[model samples]
Structures are given as structure tokens and as C-alpha cells.
Target: MGLHGEELTFGVEEEFFLVDASGQLVPRGPELVFGTEERGGELQQELIRSQVETATDVCRTAEEVLGHLTRMRADLAASAAERGLRLLPSGTPLLPKSSHEITQKERYREMADRFGAIARSSATCGCHVHVEVADRETAVRVSNHTRAWLPVLLALTANSPFSGGAVTGYRSWRHVLWSRWPSAGPPPMFVSLEHYENSVAAMLRSGAMMDRAMLYWDVRLSDNQPTLEFRICDVAATPEEATLAAVLIRGLVNVALRDVADARTPVIVPDEVLRANLWRAARDGLNGSCLHPESGELVPVWAVLDELMAGLRDALRTTGDLEFAEGMLARLRSTGGGGDRQLAAYRTRNRVTDVVDELCV
Candidate 1:
């Protein structure tokens, strides 16, 4: 909560893999612990020592996100160098490995204890951005309204073109891999926060979930904060991409909040329709059409994003970031994404090794 209760803020969590100098993802988690934890700036262990997550404190503006992410990246890069570790971003490994190891943290241990094989199979990395709402009610409202747009966001930020050491044939295989969990995918629409809580309580009573956090919906209201969290994106390979995605998320939340306040009708696609759109986005990226959440008609990826920006321009302007949003949109068009970059690098170097080098570099 900031002044006027009208503050639009952003917070992000990114997961990365610890790779060796030879550009291979090491399965040894505990061995990389010192290099990562010793850096000391919001660096935290993830489900395994081979994985690490770094987060930024709540920031009220896009520029602040840029500053924090830049500093965090620098810190992690330095820390990884000190201990013979490297950080790389991809949804999963293409090469495949033995055993899905969970980090030794109590929380994670509980996850494995509760979810069995689902928890063990969770080796994907992602980026979750938090956008502040006025209250829990608005958090639920925004989460519902934003569901139709989640797939678009996922598509735009698609960066996991490669897993282990091969092309995954999808722009975002992480989404599919994560969907295998018991409590994952797009959340059911709820009329109110109480309805959501009741559903969650029922899950707890039945032992279906360890707690609310396990919901793992692509979009959901955070239990401990007055914000809606968008967890559908892959960990961006570049700071510019991360910041751009954060700005777009902030703008989307603003658009939803305004619609909620004005009692405006939101074009919500059914859960099934939304799921179809997600599958399309994962398969096609910006190269094809996605099923519209409500209309069920195929829509171009860039068209959907452009329309979203148009609807939220006033909100972006209010945040004094209209230019920032436009700049990012242009970059997205010009640079494509990690997927495009990886494809290009592969063509030039003729190997997945070169693609990973380009991504990690």
C-alpha cells in the first residue's frame, strides 16, 4: 500500500540454472551453494542447489525495475564466477536426466512430501511478476479479468525454445511441463475472494494441496499480499526483456483495475478456451494465431498485444511510462525473443551448444 492507494507497483521472481564453464547444466546442487548464497543480495536457493531464484523488492515504476534487475543480475553473475558456476535460463532440459531433485528447504521438502511425483517433476524455471491492487477483492477481480490475457503474455515472453540440449519444438515447453502438477494451470473464475478461499479450504481439507501457494495457477491472487501474480512467463534471458514484460504486466493490471472500478464488461474467455489459446501460443509464438478467449476465433499474437496496449494506454500514461511501453513493444517486434535469437544462433553455429552460448552470454 502506497500513497492514495492508487500506486501501481511491480515485483518479480526469476529462476535460473547453475551451469558449468563447459556450458553443461550440472546436476550437483549442493556443490554450487556457496557461490550463489554468498553473493548476499536477495539470492535464494530454489528447488535445488543447481537452481537459484533472485527477486526484486516492490518497485513502483518501470525504471526502478530496470535498476533492481540490472543490479541483481550483476551480483549473481559475479557470485557464480567466484564458485565455478554459470546461470542460464530455459524452461527445462532437452537432454533429459535421472531423478527430479527437490531442494532441501523445509517448504520444498513439504512440497515433495505432499505432492509426491508431481513435486519431483518440477524442474522448470519461470518469472512471476506481482502487480499491486487496492485490496483482496480487487486482487481476485483483476485475476479473473486478466485470465483471458494470460496466454498472450506467455506467448510474448516465450524464451524456452531449448531444453537440456535440443530444441523443444515449442516456444514455451515449461507451461506444458508445469501443467502436469495436481494443482496447476489457469484457476477457475470466482465471484469473490470468499469463494476463492472456500475452494482453497476445501482443497486443504481433502489434502489436495499443502496450502494456498500450491494452487500454481497461471494467474492468481497472492495470499500474503494485495496483488495479483502472473506466473506464466519463462525466466527472460535478458534484463531488457524482463523489464519490458514487467511494464506490460503493470499496464494490464491497471487496465483491469479501471474496468473493475467502472463496472465495465470484461471479455473473459472460458477456462477451456483460455487453455486452448495457451496451447496455441506455446506452439506458435508470434508466428501464428491463438484462439480468442471469448470469441474462440483465431487472433494474431501481435494484434492481441497491440489491442491490449491500446486499451491500457491511458493507464500506462498515468504511470508516466507510455514511452517505455512503446519502446518495449518496438523491441519485441524487432528482436523477436529468446526463441528467435536461439533459432538464429543455432543456424549460424549449427549446434545447440552455440545457441546456449548465445542465451547464457
Candidate 2:
């Protein structure tokens, strides 16, 4: 929230893997992270040298996000071309990659030293959306309202279907691998801002996470920014899809704020149930069954997605994002998703490079 009561600003942080000509993840992130001074957005190294991430400047419309995301990706892709590597905006490595080096940072070094195997093998990527909030209390309330729809978001953007040159039997295997972290998953519904703070203190005391930066929940209040950060979705296949996801996230927050202003309490499920649907989203994407957010009964993923769209329709319309969002959704429905496309390509010729070739474009 800003001076305007209807202010809607957001940002997207997307992680990507570097790969060679053969589609294997490679330890070449530095070439992009250090050479991205001219990129449209800020580029940073991830925990592993095989992964790099880009953070967009604050954006108020889908066009800004598209401009920044397109330019940043093109710049990175060009840099990779110069080095004979490819910029792979994937949620997980399609082929098995050798052990990668961690970035030379004190925090990364400490993580590798303390977490051991989990840190050694963690190279998954994701797209995190941060929607502006007026304060921490509002962010908490918005997070509570947004919790039930997390899995639908994941199902929509899932793009990690192959791993180690074989079908992994899961759309976003990155979600499965990322869940190996002790603190990563759906967060508990907090009763108040105080409750949220106390819970973080408890987690710190238990040593579940090294710091506030490691909250890792699907949605949480940002420690350094006035926004509610969503860590639910995988990096989408294209810039248009990413823009769709970002605006949808903003719509959810806008609707959540309306509910909060009206003194409406959100209907929340038990933590276990939320985690159940999350796992279902990871395993099936949109091709299998998922639980209804309210009924808790298994249903087709499209039904859940329709329910989500209905909930956000008013907010999206009010924000002038309805047409752009609908266009992207139609395109995705027509062409299918990145994960499905990869599986379809693999079905032809049984070649993983064929899948990589499609992504490289």
C-alpha cells in the first residue's frame, strides 16, 4: 500500500540454472551473476554455482514485469552464448548434474558446513512473488487468506518433470527436493502479528532455520521489505506466463485486503491438509487429482483452478489485469505447460536434448 488506497505494486525473483550444450546443469553461474551489470534487473548468485537468480524492480503493471523479465533473460542468454553455455530458466535440472560448487559467500559456506548433504545437492529453482503490503500486520492477514490457494498456483506453473534423463513421475520435482529443507512448506495460520513473531522466535530457538531469511514457507511476510512473499510456484516456462503469475498474486493480495477491511475472517484448513494438497500439486501438477480448498475432498485440478480464478476475478478486473491474465491463461491451456511439453518431447525420439532445445529457445 502507498499513498493510494488501491496501490498495487509487486516484484518477482526468479531462479535459473546454467547448462551446457548437452542440457546438463553446469557450474557457470558466475558468468551471468558477475556480468549482469547491464541487465535490466538485478542478478544474484544462488546457493549453488549452477543456479543464478534475477530480481525485478518494483512493478505496478504486467508490462513492466514483461519488459524487465524479457530483457534480463535475453541479456543472460546472450552472455551464456558467449561462453558456450545456455541460460536455463528451469525449476530443476532435466539431466543429472555433477556435484556443483557453492557460491563463495560466508552464508553459503556456513550452510554447506552445517546442513551438509542437503546443501550439497540443493540446486532447485523457483519464482517468488512479493506483493506490497502496508505493514506487517496486514501482510500476516493477507498471508492467512492466501494460504488455501497455494497449491493451485503451484499446479499452474509446474515445470520440472524430468530429472537424470528419465521421467521423475512428478511435475515439479524441485518442490520435492526443496521440501527437504526443515522449514520449507505451508506455514501455520497465525492468530496475530505477535503470534507470527513468537513462532519465528521458537523456530530460531529450535535451530530449524539459520535466520529469518530461511523462513522458506510457501508464503510469508518479508523481513526486509513491506510485502508478503510467495514461494509457492516454480519458475514458469515463458515471460508471459511469469507475468500472468505475478499479476494473479497481486490480485490475491488485493482481494485479501478487501476481506480484511470488511472484517471477514478467512476460512482456513488444518496445516496437515494444506501440506497434503501441496504434495498433490507437486506430484500431479494439473493432470491429477487435488483436494478442494474448502471441502478437503479430492477433485480435478482444473476445478480447483476455476475456484481460484473466481475468487480473484473482481480484484483482477479492478486492477486492469483481467485481459492480460486471461490471454496468458488461454495460451498456456492451448500450448500446455513446460513440464507437459517436455514430457511430450521426450515421448518423441526418447531424447532429452530435444526437450532442452525447446527450452533453450
Candidate 3:
């Protein structure tokens, strides 16, 4: 019953793929970070040898978000390049040369063993944005309201449209692949935090999950942190795009909090409808259309996002993030999502390497 409204804050986590000079996926993992540090490199707390995660300090204003994100991305790119690697933003980096090339971390190894090919196939990159709430109640409320907006986020961020040496059909094959795990998918709507916790507890007791974090819902409460995490986005093709995504996610949370506080009950579509919307986002990416939350009628995905932005303009102004949000949407509309670029690159070059080059550069 913890639905008390609260002011919002922000955090960001960006997962990047390591690429060689030729723009091929490199299994450098966190070993790259370690190797760099051993050689007087300057990154820390990375997730794997080939992948590094950057987390921003909690931010209050959108300016602070932009400032911190820009600095972090530049630093990470510089450090990674010094070690003969580049960071590519994508969901999965065309699968490794072999599954054995997975990250060397024990946890990663165990994940591969437990999840089998699904884990091995998860050489994906993503950007996860966290918005802070005053308490668990507000967090739950934001989470509930937030799910309906996720497919649009996915459509905006669509970047991974291919896998291995073949076209994967769906714009974000990684979303489908990532959902292969038993616990992966949208979270069911629960009436209270207690109900949510009980569901997680039942999964844990049944030996289906390791902990709360592994629930792997499109959006969920961070068990170890005081925020709701949205993981529906693909890794962006550029640091600027990633920053834009972080800004939009932060803005959405503030708007959701305001709506809840003002007695505007959140409108979430049925789970099945949401699933269909997500599939449409993956299949069509930016070129695809989605169902409107209220009318259940098909609307151009970008048009729906435009309406959402217009609706949230007041909240954006109140949070002083309106310009940043608008600017980001402009870029998304012009450049399209990651999957759009990948498709374009594939059209011209007829090679996945070309797509990787487009992704990194």
C-alpha cells in the first residue's frame, strides 16, 4: 500500500560492447578494464571483461544529468580506445565467434551453464535508466504507470536489427532473445508492494530465481537501490543518444509521479496488449506502429511518442527538462532508432561488419 507520491531523482547505467578496430565484437570483457588498470588505465567496477557499465552519480536537474553522462561516456571511450578497442552500443553484438568466448567471470560462466545457449547468446548491450522515488510506495506507483510507456521507449531506441551473419527480422532480436529466460518478460500488475514481494518470494522459494534483481521484468524496482529501473531500451548508437534516453526516462518518471499525486490514475494496457506492443516495436522498430493505450487503435509509434511528449510538456517544464526532452525527440525522429541505422548500413554494405561500424561510429 506504499503509493505515496514523491519527488524524483535520476541515475543511469550504460552497457557497451567492446569492438576491435575492424568493428567486430571483442570478448575483452572486464579484462579490458583490468588490463587497462594494470597498465595504468582509469576505469573501475566494470561488469565483465568485454563489457563495462558506467553509472552516473544521482542527479537532480536535467543539466546535471547531461553533464555527468557526457563526461562519463567520453572518459569510457577514451580509456577503451587506449586498449585497442571501441565501445559499440547495441543489444547483442552479432553473437560471438563462439559461445565459449563468453565473458570469463565466474558469475557469467555460471549464467551460461544455467541458462545454456540463452546466456551464451546474450552478447547484447543496453542502457538502463533509474529514477529515484521518495519511498517504495511511490516507486511501485511509478513502476505501474511506467510499463505502458516502455514499448514506445523500445521503439525509440531500436538499434539491434541483425544477429550473427543474418538479418533477424525483428528490429530488436535481443529483446526476444533476452526474454528467453524463464523469468524474463513484463511484470504482472500487482495491487500492492506486498503482493509484488510475495510473487518474487514465491519464485525464489521455487528455485526459479536467484534474487529480486533476476526477475528481469521490462521495468521493476531495484532491490538493492531506491529506484525503479527501466530496461526496455537497446544500447544507443551514440553517447548523445544514450544521454537523451536517460533524460527522457527521468522526465517520464516525474510526469508519472505528478499524475499520481494529482489523482490521475495511471492507464496501463492489459499485459497481453503490452506484449503485442513490445513485439510490434521489435518487429517494426521506428517504422512500426503501436496501439494507443486508451483507444486500442493503431497509431504511428513516433506520433504516439509525440503526443506523450506534448502531454508531458508541463511536467517537463516544471522539472526544467523540457528542452532536453524535446531536443532528444528531435534526434530520434530524424535519425530513427538503432535498428533503422543498422538496416541502412546493411542495405549499403551487405555485411554485419558494416553495421557494427555504423553502430560504433
Best candidate per lDDT, number? 2
Kindly list the per-residue Cα lDDT of model 1 for residues 108-151, writing each as its tens digit: 99988877777777777898898887488778877777888888
Error of 2 at 354 (Å): 1.2
lDDT for each residue of candidate 3 in 261-333, tens digit (9 for 90 to 100): 7767778689899888888887888768988777888889888888878877776776677887788777777
Output the lDDT of residue 109, model 3: 72
Residue 326's lDDT within candidate 1 is 92
lDDT of each: 0.76, 0.85, 0.74
TM-score of 2: 0.96
Score residue 136 of candidate 3 by CA lDDT. 77
Clashes of 3: 17
Name the weakest run of 10 consecutive residues (lDDT summed) in model 2.
1-10
Cα RMSD (Å) per model? 2.5, 1.5, 3.3
Better of 2 and 3 by TM-score: 2
- Predicted candidate 1, C-alpha RMSD: 2.5
Instruction: Rank candidates by TM-score, best first.
Output: 2, 1, 3
Model 3 RMSD in Å is 3.3
Rate residue 90 of model 3 by lDDT.
79
